[model samples]
Target: MTAENNGTGTPPPEGDDDPFAYLYRQEGGAGGSAQQPGVPRRSYAQVRAVGERQYGAQAGPSPQAAPGQQPGSGPGLPPHQPNAHYAAPETMPGGRAAARRQAAAAGGGPGGPRKNRNGLLIGAIAVVAAVIVGIGAAIVFNDDSGKQSQGQSDNNDVPGQDEDKNPKNPKDGDKKPAKDKPKPTGLPSRTDAADATLAGGATKQTEVAKAQSAGGAYVGGMDKPGASVTWTLKDIPESGKYTVFVRYGVPGKDADSTLSVNGKQSDRPLNMSNFAGAKKGDWEAGWAETYSWIDLKEGTNRVQVACGDSNTCDFVLDQFWLKRGWVK
Candidate 1:
């Protein structure tokens, strides 16, 4: 008998309604499609069961492996689990393996990785060598700079050195003024020599009417030709060129004489005539002065004043003076 609407198996109301619509319809908000409009479809629970058994719990099936083929277990590759976290180095197939094989073919053998490591090491060594060379060059350059600076400093000090060695070089136009030289001074001591005697004709000791000196005495009457007055100085402490100053009196006329010390004639003769005209008076009343110089020997000395060629000495000799040095 045919199942009717009232029986356990019932026919749906049919007015252009699909007989298999319920089979393809959504179940518990999950959707599935059928091969044909009238064909039945599997349920969501059944589809989920099939997927779990075919693939892993969380991962989809890899396209590289066929339906029955294992993952990462291709021919000429190592055996590996399909659900493992990572594949072995030898089992890393497909594009990565193909790339590694290509690299190995280009590089010679399995030693390609080692060669790459060696190349990296060589590159690092080259970088280090370059850095060291750069540092060495910098040090050399700094040394040269220091030497140049020292040379410059030495050059700068050269002028001062030269100035120190020769403080007054004529070539230096702009020079500081030189200090003045010291003036010449007179002799340190004097020797009084008033005692003398007549050495030749017409020369004798005379006394003045009025005292003008300590002894008030002199050598007089020197009017004869070849007459001379002599003095023998003793105990002379020094031997050097000495000055001889003569104090004398003039009576309105001039006198001429020459001096000799130790038998050596003076360089120049003396003229006592110039002293008499400066003052007009008697011979013994006014005194005048004249001087000459000669070298005196040590211990004792002999000085003689002789009349000139005119054969007459009119002046009266009063005293003698012996100084250490002569005037320039």
Candidate 2:
């Protein structure tokens, strides 16, 4: 029965603001009649069948083009597939999915399967979000790594000179024997030696004292009962400490030993004798040392020591590492 005769009819004026929209939804929207708001004069059997399968096998056209053709080809390259995996991208510039989606929903053309539209929306959003998050994390890590690398580079930098070259005192290698410095600052009062140790910047200080020896090497000390003036240091600094080093060998053999300073003792015993060395003609045994840190109240402190242990070997006092500060 026509709604008009039933008293529930809508106003029949063309001015009805929203008539077609209401009718369109009710008809699944493929068509409408001129006489009635939603009446379609024709019955669409196939269209109805396709629409009924909107969420199932009806999602897209059967993977064929005409009665007998392959899916990805017709004549030239089968135009790029519309990335149909997800809800077609929002308003993709090519206006492709909208018509199909509508036609399928309305049983008009190749209708899509009646799949859960909600799940597809969620999945598409998830993929896009994952890509964005991945890109963001990479950018942050890269920036942090760059800063760390810059810090390490700064630490490895050399300050004043060529990092590759070994450091050396400038006076080294000069031909002229460097004028002997007048001993250390207070060495004169300690013992009288022509030049026991270099005061200025000379690199090496050698033993120039006269001592007891049977062979080419000399060995002497306060070990027995005699006074042995091996080498006299000049003006030894009261603030700095002194280190005694020597090389020695036992009678006819090498022996280990250490030098005593002002009655001081070695943490370990000496290892040598004067003329008695490791090799017959070789006098190659000595220690590189620094003196124990000591503070002397006055200048020209008296310094004394003897060399020898079991065999009292011959020894040569080599170098002294001296610096200004008393606090070592």
Candidate 3:
């Protein structure tokens, strides 16, 4: 009813120029929305059809160059070395040709040769890729290890943790009570005080036999001039240096004091071993550093505590301190 004249009518023929020509000439990427004039508007079916034609053409043999010209002389191919051993097949076969076909069928000609070449190329490529991956993995692992070490260090430095594991940590806890330092043999913890009192008010003070006082108290000398006292020293546990604490008291005039162990002047400054500079005195504090690897004799040893004037530092002869080992 809509087309009253349609029953016997025919449509006009389409134009002759290639309607698909626009599909082949574009240079842009495949997925963008930007439009270009002159480019064919493509439906999915049209695009797929054009693509098949192009792919088939490329996959087939390319056009040959002019007769007598080399394969790579045109823009179509890169420069190449002619394969001297490869020759085009002839239409007519000679005895050599027959033999080559037979060899190929037997796995010694075209098939075997091509197969070997492909396998070698693949193996070489795989080895190179494996080496590259190994190097990359090693570098990554080393970086991760370094990060782990840094993390451990950060953990150790976290607040509220025991710094005993820290290299810069300080000493802590109750120090093991000092061991008795070596003292001059044949003397009690107290031996002098000739009218002076003992340090710390501990009544364990007493005089030694005058005979023991000036005796040959050494495998060396007068273990030093003094009333021998119970000398406590740190245990020589390991190799290192330690500090020894001592206290002394006595009376004298304008007298400075000196402390020594076993005939030798102790190797530490003692400018404050006494405050006797003002007269009638009480105990004064002192300290010393003893090197390890030194054997401390048990029991009493003469620790000459002398109190003297500028002309002499006197020996209070009756004071000693508890000792302990501190390592550095």
- Comparing 1 and 3 on TM-score, the stronger one: 1
Candidate 1 on 1-328: residue-level lDDT in tens?
2212211123435553553444454323213222333323333233321122222335553324333444345664344334334333454556567767767888854778688888899999999999999999999999999999988876675644563634666687877678875533433232222356675664435465442345565667666667777777776666787877777776767776778888777767766764545445465545677888678756777888887674346766666767777852
Stretches off by above 4 angstroms in model 3 are: 1-235, 252-254, 267-269, 272-319, 322-328
Higher lDDT: candidate 1 or 3? 1
| Candidate-wise lDDT, in order | 0.59, 0.40, 0.40
Query: What is the C-alpha lDDT profile of model 2 across 283-312, one tens digit per residue?
Result: 333222234443333344433334333534
- lDDT of model 3, residue 294: 22
Rank all candidate structures by their TM-score, best first, as comma-separated numbers. Answer: 1, 2, 3
Report the Cα lDDT for candidate 2: 0.40
Segments in model 2 whose C-alpha atoms lie over 4 Å from true places: 1-227, 230-234, 245-253, 264-267, 270-297, 307-328
Which ten contiguous residues of candidate 1 have the minimum total lDDT?
A: 1-10
Q: Write the per-residue lDDT of candidate 3 for residues 82-177, one digit (tens) a residue.
A: 333333344225667876887898888986878999999999999999999999999999999999998888776657665566444347654657
Leading candidate by TM-score = 1
